[model samples]
Target: MAKKPTKDPNYKVIAENRRARFDYAIEDDVECGIVLQGSEVKSLRQGGSNIAESYATVDDGELWLVNGYIAPYEQAKTWGHEERRRRKLLVNRKELAKLWNATQRQGMTLVPLVMYFNHKGLVKLKIGIAKGKKTQDKRATEAKRDWQRQKARLLRDRG
Candidate 1:
């Protein structure tokens, strides 16, 4: 068998919105490029960014990331970027149309799932096409998770 490729050392997760999976059901996800200033990139490298409160939107034929937070870079005193400013997301025309249709016609949401550096050291965002979960749905999910944990524990003990 051919040797499996190893994980890329350059790939690193900067921020992840763990709550998104709990609050919404993710049907699909797409990787997107984000436009960032120098200061913002420096801040992300230092690793205090937050994507929990951020979301993606398709507007005027372009995708944008809104409410994303990148901590200010102290060294870049004069040219520091805004911490919560909207950032533009890059995607192809066909993907943009699909995202728009999902949001406008299917009533889905574009939730930011993770921000990470790819193998080539370029930053990327994974945005999910999700639908909001009802309270009962959340409860059922929690119950299922609890059962899974209990079952694992039982298996471990018996083995």
Candidate 2:
């Protein structure tokens, strides 16, 4: 019997954009701090967030996360945050410059890959600087993955 993987109580993933890797070719990634309201943080702690359709952008020399969703905290009805709101991301000047250059000059995209709480229990967002893939490129990637899976199966059977 196989042993199940242990779960870490402190480290938890609130949301992940699994399609980001499939749709974009990630060139580089950076972890960023997000500005959130009290209610937003409480909602995220309950795992009521989605990063699948969200992205990051550098605007006016500041990094911002766009279209990210944090569900409303029912108890905080009076001070609940908007479900979808633009949130500022914290990054150093040097990293901000790099991301700006990648997007403006190189025409790369800032895709949100994952949103989670680190070991210290602070929220972090991982954004990837990626170039969008053409349809043919996506098909090729799929084929390559399939071949790798088949090869691994064949080796296991032969060994």
lDDT of residue 71 for candidate 2: 94
Instruction: Give a tens-digit lDDT track for model 2, residues 51-75.
Output: 9999899999999999999999999
Per-model CA lDDT versus the true structure: 0.96, 0.95
- Weakest lDDT window of 10 consecutive positions for candidate 1: 39-48
lDDT of 1 by residue, 40-141 (tens): 888899997999988999999999999999999999999888999989999999999999999999999999999999999999999999999999999999
Off by over 4 Å in 2: 1-8
Cα error, candidate 2, residue 86 (Å):
0.3
Where is model 1 more than 4 Å wrong at Cα? none
How close is each model in CA RMSD to the real structure? 0.8, 3.7
TM-score of 1: 0.98
Q: List TM-score per model, in order.
A: 0.98, 0.92
- Residue 85 in candidate 1 has what lDDT? 90
